[model samples]
Structures are given as C-alpha cells and as structure tokens.
Target: MPPGGRQVLGADLGVVDHAACAGEEPELFFHGDPGAIALAKRICGRCPVREACLARSIANDERYGVFGGLTADERQELQGRRAAA
Candidate 1:
C-alpha cells in the first residue's frame, strides 16, 4: 500500500513533462488549463494522503505540475494564505 493510492512516486504520471519541470523555466502544472485542472482535482479528491502530499509540495516549492490534485498556482496561493495566517 502506498500513500497516494499508488505504489510509486511517479505512478499514474500524467502528460506533464518532467524535463520541463526540472529545467530552468518550469512548466505550470495543469498547463494553466482549467479543464485539466478540474480533472486533476477529481483525481486528488480520492487520494488518501492528499493533505500530506499537498503539504510536501508546498514545503518543497514544487514548480511543476499538479500535486495532491492541486495546480502550482493553487498550491502557491494556499501557501501564501497559510503564511499570511
């Protein structure tokens, strides 16, 4: 059993190119596409470790695609609100 309903880190890995993520100019998770983001949110909705995953992404400053079903901007916005509080 894994934390994210999968047995691996990159399991069910979507189309977001990791190379682009690792590169200097990272691609935005969800590609700034609302439909894709909605799909991602649906996936995240069922994740067992959703909170842990989201927290990890925020803490690590993940600059790439969605994590715990949240887009990069959503995560950043959440992080900002958390910091403000």
Candidate 2:
C-alpha cells in the first residue's frame, strides 16, 4: 500500500478524501516485513488525512496493518498513553 492502506478500506475511502495510500499495493500495508512497514509509514507521513486515518484505526481497533504511520503495536501504545493521560 502507499501508506495508510487506502483501497483496503473501500467503504471508508470516501470518508477520508485524498487518501495518500490510494492505488498502492495493499499488501504493503499488511506485510510482516519491518522494511515494508517502514515504507508504508513513510507513505502515510505524507498523507493529508493521516490523523483521520489514525483516528479510524483507533476507533475500530484495527490490529493487522500500518495506519496513520503507526504499526499495530504503536497504535496500542498511543491508546495506552491517551488513556493514561
């Protein structure tokens, strides 16, 4: 995927306009490879709807792919921090 896995969420594609990851290889977003994950995150770093993408991932508890420049574990840590705060 380009970054935040645009096409994978065809349903939410319309929700987050101009997804940066659009048309990219979806597998890149879900890859177990660290390098691929980093590439996806880099793609997400340039995305306009990054916060929105992250919000959606957090809201849905998405646990399998990169979103909003964060890996699943990162998202969990973010949520933990938010909860603690």
Candidate 3:
C-alpha cells in the first residue's frame, strides 16, 4: 500500500480507490484529540495487531494523525530517539 494508505484496486489497477485508508481513520486520530487517543490506547493496549500497526506508522512517517494509539508527535519523538541512539 502507498504511504498515505491509498491503494489501487481491481486487477487492472486503473481504477482509483481508498479501501486501505478506510475502516478506521479514527485509528489515526490520536494526535488530533487526547480524549480519543486515550480511548484508542485502551483498546490498542491489548490488540494483537498493535505492533504491526505501530511499525507501519513509523515506516510511513505518519505526520498528520495517530496509529497504534500513538500521536504524530510521539512517533516523531520515537524516531528522533532512535536516530540519536
């Protein structure tokens, strides 16, 4: 999938769609709202896909929202810390 979660659908890949960015843009809203983030974090705290989701967010350098229950600024800080280390 593309970094922004956009993907081409169908066998021909000619049609345009956003299925990958669907389902839960909510999942990426932790940066925009603290209360929502807290709620999502509670759920993600126990989700099996948390690691996978976090990995994707970091790889994508997601800058506008949250993923895996982490805010954009938090993810950036993590990246910075890793780079510094």
Candidate No. with top TM-score: 2
By descending TM-score, how would the candidates be arranged? 2, 3, 1
Q: For residues 10-72, could you state the per-residue lDDT of candidate 2 as single tens digits?
A: 345565658888868989999999899989999999998888788878877899899999999
lDDT of 3 by residue, 1-85 (tens): 6554543222222221322323455545545566877766666665555655666667666786656657778888888899999
* TM-scores for candidates 1 onward, in order: 0.58, 0.81, 0.63
So what's the TM-score on candidate 3?
A: 0.63
lDDT of each: 0.60, 0.84, 0.59
> In model 3, how many backbone clashes occur?
1
* Superposed Cα deviation of residue 72, candidate 1 (Å): 0.8
Give the number of the best model, judged by lDDT. Answer: 2
Worst 10 residues of 3 by lDDT: 7-16
| Candidate with the larger lDDT of 1 and 3 | 1
Better of 1 and 2 by TM-score: 2
